[model samples]
Target: MNILITNDDGVYADGIFELANKVKAIANVYVVAPDSEKSAIGHAITIHNPLMVKKVNFRNTDIDAYAVSGTPADCVKLGIEAILEDIHIDLVLSGINNGPNLGTDVIYSGTVSGAMEGLVQNKPSIAISYDGKNISSKEYEKGAEYVVQFIDKIKDNLTMLDDTMININIPDIRDTKINGFKVTQLGIRRYENTFEKRIDPRGNIYYWLGGKTVELEQDENSDVTAIKNGFIAITPLKYDLTHYDRIGRIMKEIQPLDI
Candidate 1:
């Protein structure tokens, strides 16, 4: 199997490197990711500025790796279209991310976006994340190991529909035993946003975006709920944003309107 791995955390992050090392044992791994952190960048692409790429030695792994001066989506796009164009990528895996990408936050996740980009190119893709917000860095290897095992288990039976992507979130398992995998749906994850206004040394005003997660009632089968109960959450996602059920109702209501 040939796997292309990318992450929102920069090329130097331990999560990506550890994942690459573990996955290389089972597949031909290739790493293409941002040169610097682009967390929560969503599906943004670098169009206005020229994208710069450089080959990098990725730790103890011998896999081909590149650092891109762009977002996670750009890294995957460039890797497929330009960097590794001659290669047939069997799977595109994103993350083993530095933090959790749970519930509604996936909409703003660059890690998830990286995998979604692979789906856009007609490749099987998955995004895996660890609950690292409160965990130690030493635990990343364990998370990587779990991800590799999951991939190995599904590698033979993996069949991705054209419009779908797989998203996985691993809870912080340092203190708790894993409750195994749960196929789940996205849950509500609203944030109480805070924008602190501040002045620069030169007296210019600026706002720094910051927020804490707002606790809300979640469904029993939600990704958030699974994580809270110590399970690995797997959610299948599609890029289609159309409200199909509403379309017919809206058309019926508007059909009598003259141009």
Candidate 2:
């Protein structure tokens, strides 16, 4: 299997490095990630600016890697559109992200967006993430190991029709045993957006975007709830934002007259 890997945490991030090291044994791995952290960058592409790509070495890991000066989505786009057009990429795995992509967190996750890009092009993909920032590099080794074990079971059976891209979040507790996996839905993450006003040396007013206070509602099958309860959360997400269930009801309220 030919697997294309990328992440939002840049080329040097331990999470991506651990992921690559583990998956290399399962397939031909290619790493094309951002040159620097591009967190919360959504699904953006570098259409107006020139994008750059440079080869990078992951000290101990003998794998093909590249650093891209672009958003996470752009890396995957460029990987397929330009970099590996000749190579038959069977799967695109994004992240083992530094932080969790739970709930509607997927909307702002560059990690999930990277995988979404591959799924958009009809390729099988998966996005992996760690729930807590306190998780050590050694902990990621365990998470990636589990990912390899999980992939080995599903890789050959995974068709484009069966599973496209799913967001997977692992808990951060080093000794906490995983209860198992849950097929979850996206949870609602309540946000308190605050912009802190500041003055630069040039005496210009600037605002720094602040972190959100995350609160998950009690939904048993939600990704947030699953992660909070010590199970690995696996959510099958789609790029289509259409609210199909509401379309019929909305159409009935808007009557069209013959003109």
Candidate 3:
């Protein structure tokens, strides 16, 4: 299969590189990613400035790679729109991200957005993340195995045509004693203090994002709860933001009486 791999953690990130190498053995893998880490950039695209892509080599790997001057979502857009237009892209895999993209974190995650870009083009995409930021290359090997296994099953099944792309967050636990996989919904993962302001040289101001203290108050069958309970969380997210169920009620309450 022609699989295109990209990440928000840049081209040379340990998780991305490790994932690329592992998947190369199973399928045709092509890597196109940001020149540097663009974490939490959301689904931003470069419009005013021209985006550039350059071929680069990793430390010891001979993978076909490109470093793009854009966000993670921009990388996928460029890959589909301009880079590999003639090539038929079968699957788009985003990350082996350094941190878990669980719950509402997907909103600000470049990792999930990269894959979302692929889905926008009617292509199958997968967004994978490691639960911990300190995940090692060895731990990514396990994620790599799981990715291949997951795709293999889907390729064999081919029953669900309406299935949306997935947001998969795998735990960094190396014990392999996982609570298995669960198709979950998005959970609430909000930070108490999202940013911390500080002064730089010349007394210039700057801000740093604080860590998230995940909450599961109103949600039990959610990605956060699944991960917290030792399960590999798979939340099938879509690009559609419409509230179809509440449309009639909202229209009845807000519509003008002119008609």
Clashes of each: 0, 0, 0
RMSD of 1: 1.6
Winner by lDDT: 1
Root mean square deviation (Cα) for candidate 2: 1.9
**Please, what are the lDDT tens digits per residue for candidate 3 over residues 1-259?**
7888999999989989888888888788889899999998999999988998998986667877999999988899898888888888888899999989988789999999999998887788889999876788889988888887778768654334234788998976864467788889999887776788999989999999777574548477899888878888888888888999999998899879576
* Model 1 stretches with alpha carbons more than 4 Å out: 134-137, 201-203
Candidate 1 residue lDDT tens string, 197-238: 999999999999999999999999999999999899999998
Which of candidates 1 and 2 reaches a greater TM-score?
Answer: 1
Candidate 2: what lDDT? 0.86
The residue-level lDDT of candidate 3 at 33 comes to: 97
What is the lDDT ranking, best to worst?
1, 2, 3
lDDT (Cα, tens digit) per residue for candidate 2, span 52-134: 99988876677889899999889988898888889988889998898888887789999999999989877888999998767
Residue clash pairs of candidate 2: none
Model 3 regions lying over 4 Å from their true place = 157-163, 199-206, 257-259
